[model samples]
Target chain A: MIRTEQAEVVYPNGTRALAATSLTFAPGAFTVLLGPSGAGKSTLLRSLNGLVRLTAGKVVAEEADDLREPHALRRHRRRTGMVFQQHQLIGRATVLANVLTGRLGYHSGLRTLLPFSATEKRRALDAVARVGLIEYALRRCDQLSGGQQQRVGIARALVQEPALILADEPVASLDPATAERVLSLLHGICKADGIAAVVSLHQLEFARRFADRIVGLAKGAVVFDGSPSKLGRAETLRIYGAEPADNDEDSEEPLQLKTGTHA
Target chain B: MLAPSAGHIGILHEHRRAVLRHAGLVGVIVLVCFGALWLTGFFDAQRLIEGGPALGQLASEMVPPDFSRWRAWVGPLVDTLAMSIAGTALAIVISLPLALLAAPNTSPNFAVSQSCRLILSALRSVPELIMGIVFVAAVGFGALPGVLALALHSTGMVGKFYAEAIEHVDPRPLEAARAAGASRFQVITHAVLPQVLPQLADITIYRWEYHFRASTVLGIVGAGGIGFELIAALRVIRYDQVSAILITILLCVVVVDSLGAWLRKQLK
Candidate 1:
């Protein structure tokens, strides 16, 4: 489990993205960081992975080296996976090649220059199949649709086999149905593999319906940290602001958290 | 950031005045440049008119491009091609690493990047003809000197283009690789190499075509290529032979240009 001990991050431009926040993430659980845009959700998530260093306090992980040291930080990152909002797939490469990048962290530079080992190749293919992109494996990534590209991004993260996965708005650009499918696939894969997943989402309904534990963030502080069942209407309005009606969102959307292992 | 309002007559008039002032400044600069040129006696209308009959006479003599000297022209043409190939190949090898060093993002430090830029500028300052003369003095006249000159000078131009291209690569893939704990070298190989290799190939082929044309002229400095033949023919006033040499160089350049274009298309 990773925990931030009163962690704080203040950008050089005097923007306090995360202000003296304390949070914990457990293994094999789907924890969604819920907030509207500019809610410091990304900064909080990045701080956990050492991508954004806290200007004060400290972030620590149990059974792992201190992230304060550079070498230890890299080692810790090797065990962690990240999926970007833009998918960040290498556009010129084949789908399989982008997935093989997941193994880049595990190989030496000279070894990587040579062809990937048969074992790694097989793993890459398996990852592609896991995301149902087997047919597109040999195709260049730019040829894929936005939804397919995000699926490839998931395949890339899956190939890493990291103990924890951090997704920064993985489905932000995707349409509602595609977003649901991608998020469900991601949540299913993480749960099945017993890997912890921390996904940042702006959609209240999706976060409420999908995440096992939802961490609400607003104005750079943890506003709520509890099970999805406990998040009341007042808390929702408070987190997203009072204009939920004017924002054209359903005021009372059902929060049916997925139960029974998705077979 | 405020937009100028139409109601502000003073501001509108000032804008027009600023434009008129700039135009006046440009006119004065043009006048000064023309005055300097006149004072130096650089413009020679008489010499231009006087050369018309002589040019016509030379053109009349060059009517039959003497293909009888074709046997003699082949060796130097081949030598020019060889020089271009060798020079371009070596330049690519040398500049590839330097381009990586010169790029702002990939460079080890700002000092290294600036130093590489400085080196490229210094190398590019001297024209390839001047470089050929220098090399011919150092290494003696031959295709080797021509190759050395072309390679050294083209490195600067090609390296700069490469640095610019590499610097413009999207930052997303780089961040993904780095976040995966990829070392700097690993990130370069995995992220940077794939994106820039095609562009690098395209730039190198274009430079090769340019060097091919430059290599022909390099022999004028006694570096040994077709230019030596052309210059020799010109000195003796053999317009027919000069015409043949010029035609051969033109044909070679056109062929190389097509080949370069085709190869670049393939890379794309």
Candidate 2:
């Protein structure tokens, strides 16, 4: 299990991205972080792998030293896979080459200069097949569609054989159907592999559908932490800091007035 | 109505002022151009008309370019080509590391990046011809000086281009690599190089083409090549031989440019 001890993040420009908050991510559970934009979802998710250096406190993983130690941090990172919103594949490289990069941490820098071993190649190929992109394995990533590219990103992460997965708005750029498909693929993989996943998402529907547990945030602090069925309308309002638009007539009047003033 | 009309008049006045300002700037530019022409005696129509026959006579002398000396020109031609190829290879060797050091994303620290940039600028401040003269004086008259000059001068330009390419790579892939626990060197090889390889190749080939032309000029400064033979012919008033050498240089340049184009296509 990976956990943070009151970990917080304040960027150099003085933006309080995440308040001092502690949480534990258990193995074999899929946790979804639900929040509005800029509500510390990404900040908290990134801190788990030491990607966002916390301004205060530290992250601890089972059997590992404090993440502040470079050696321990690298070890933590090797077993942690991160998915990005932009899919982040090296566009000029083939899908196979991009997936093989996941195995880089398993070898020394000098050893990676040579071609990967056959076992490693087989593993990358298997990941590609799992993503259902076996036919496009040798094709350049730039030529793939956005959905396919995100799958390539997933394959790259999968080849790491990670114990934990962190995804930040991974489907924010895709269409509704494609988004659902990508999330399902990721959710299925994490379930089958028993990898703990901490995925931040903007869509409440997807979160409620796929999450084993839901953690909600607002203004850099968690407002609700429970199972998806337990997330009441009040809890949703607290997490988003607003009411659902369809039922909020009072809110609609104020919104219209604000836009009128702007005009 | 009166107040609104006054505001309209105020707007029109502002527009008129802007127009006047633009007109004044254009007038000043035209005056400076005429002044420069006058200073250079470029307006002397009488002298231009009178010089036509002199140019015609020079052209006449250059016709029927002497192929008699072609046998001796081969060695110098080869020397020029060799100098350019060797110089470009050496420049690429030096520039890649310097570029990596100078790029803000890859540099170890701000001081190293700034110092590397300073070195590139200092190298670039001197032209290849000037550097060729210095190298010739230092190494004595030979093709060695030409090669040295081309490499040093080209490094300045090639390194800056390479640094720019490296600096602009998509940072997302780098983040992904880092998050995957790849070492810094591993991240660079897998993420950075793959993104910028084609752009870097294009820059190197373009620089090689430019260096080929510059190497010929280096030969004029006692760095032995075809330019040296051309200059020798000029000294003896052998206009025909000079013309022949000029033609040879043009043909070689065309060949080099076409080769570079083909290589760039292959890279793509």
Candidate 3:
């Protein structure tokens, strides 16, 4: 479980990116934070891991009760895994090598220095298999498609084995179909692994399909947080300030069979 | 369709301008080269011709090359080679930390990186010969001074190149390492070092070759090496002995160059 109490983030330039935003994340659920650009979605996600330090209030995440000391923040960050907007895959390294980096926090300084042992290699391979990219494990990151690269990013996070996964616009760069597939993958992985996942998405349909709960943010404030069935057109207009022009007109819309399995 | 205007040039107009610019640049280069040759007296062909026979006769007198004193000369030659090796080795050791400190991203603070860059620039501004003279005065005439001069000179060159190599490293791996909770040291070892190692090896070998060349001349300041022998040969008008030393130096340079190339290939 992760919770932030009146967590506020102010940049060095005095820009208040987040203003007293507070929320609690339930475990083993796929939570989607829906918002427009500059709505504090990314900032809120970064705050969960203490990457963006909060100028006021406390961040209570699993295994990280405090954020005052830099050392403690780093130690707490180990339990929080984050994916970025750009996928942020190391383009020059092999896919397998990139995934192994996720295990860096678990190893000692000397072990990190030495080459990966057989057991470490096996674990990395297993993570690769989990992402369904075992065949491309040895391929360079640049060779993979955007969807495949995002999968590798997920694999990297999975290797962290974090209690909570924070994905900041993870599929924003993929095509509509690919985005659907990736989000479905994320939903399935979170459910199976029993890990809490907070995925930020701009597209409402995709969020509505996979999210157990959708948290809407407008102007750096959480306007709505509830089940997907409860998120109606009025609430979305409050979040986006306009009715989506083509909800029924997506040429490649994902086949929404059933909403996320949750009671 | 838009007409070519003062603010914008057409393809043909730009092509003509480019030709004019290149022509002007070449003209300036030729003029500078001629001016330099004239100032240095290198263009005085008549003066060179007048000394040809005297130079030939002087060269002939030092024949047999005075190899009978091999015992004396061999030790100084060894000393020169050792000076090169030791100086390059020391420079390599110092350059590693200096490179990390000089790198803007890898370095912890901007002030530290900037200060290290400034210090390297200061060291590089003084030539090895000047460094040799300064060291000789402080430490007395010996290979110790030569080693110090070579080491200091190479440190400047190596550190600058090494920092550049560090700067060009891909930031993605570093980000991944950081996100994975790797400490600064681990990030440097896993991401930065591997990316920069090949280029670093190339730079080190090139520096070694350059230091070897510099070491041969360090003896001119009484810093012990074959340069002392070369100076003695020149002072005594034993041009043949000088010629012999020059040939040996040429051979040694070629050997080192080839060896360095081979080692670089192996590293690659």
- What lDDT would each prediction earn against the true structure? 0.85, 0.89, 0.83
Order the numbered candidates by TM-score, best leading.
2, 1, 3
- Candidate 2 RMSD computed on C-alpha atoms after optimal superposition onto the true structure: 4.2
Q: How many backbone clashes does candidate 2 have?
A: 0
* Model 2: pairs clashing at backbone N, Cα or C within 3 Å: none
- Per-residue lDDT of model 1, residues B40-88, tens digit only: 8768778768888988987999978877788988898899999999999
Q: Compare candidates 2 and 3 on TM-score and give the better one.
A: 2
**Candidate 3 deviant stretches above 4 angstroms:** A107-118, A135-145, A176-178, A243-263, B1-82, B134-144, B222-229, B266-268
Write out the backbone clash pairs for model 3.
none
Tens digit of per-residue lDDT, candidate 3, span A92-150: 67899888878777766677768877887898899899889999999989899999999
Model 1 residue A126 CA deviation in Å: 0.8
Native contacts present in each candidate (fraction): 0.56, 0.77, 0.46
Backbone clash pairs for candidate 1 read none
DockQ (Cα-based) per candidate? 0.53, 0.73, 0.43
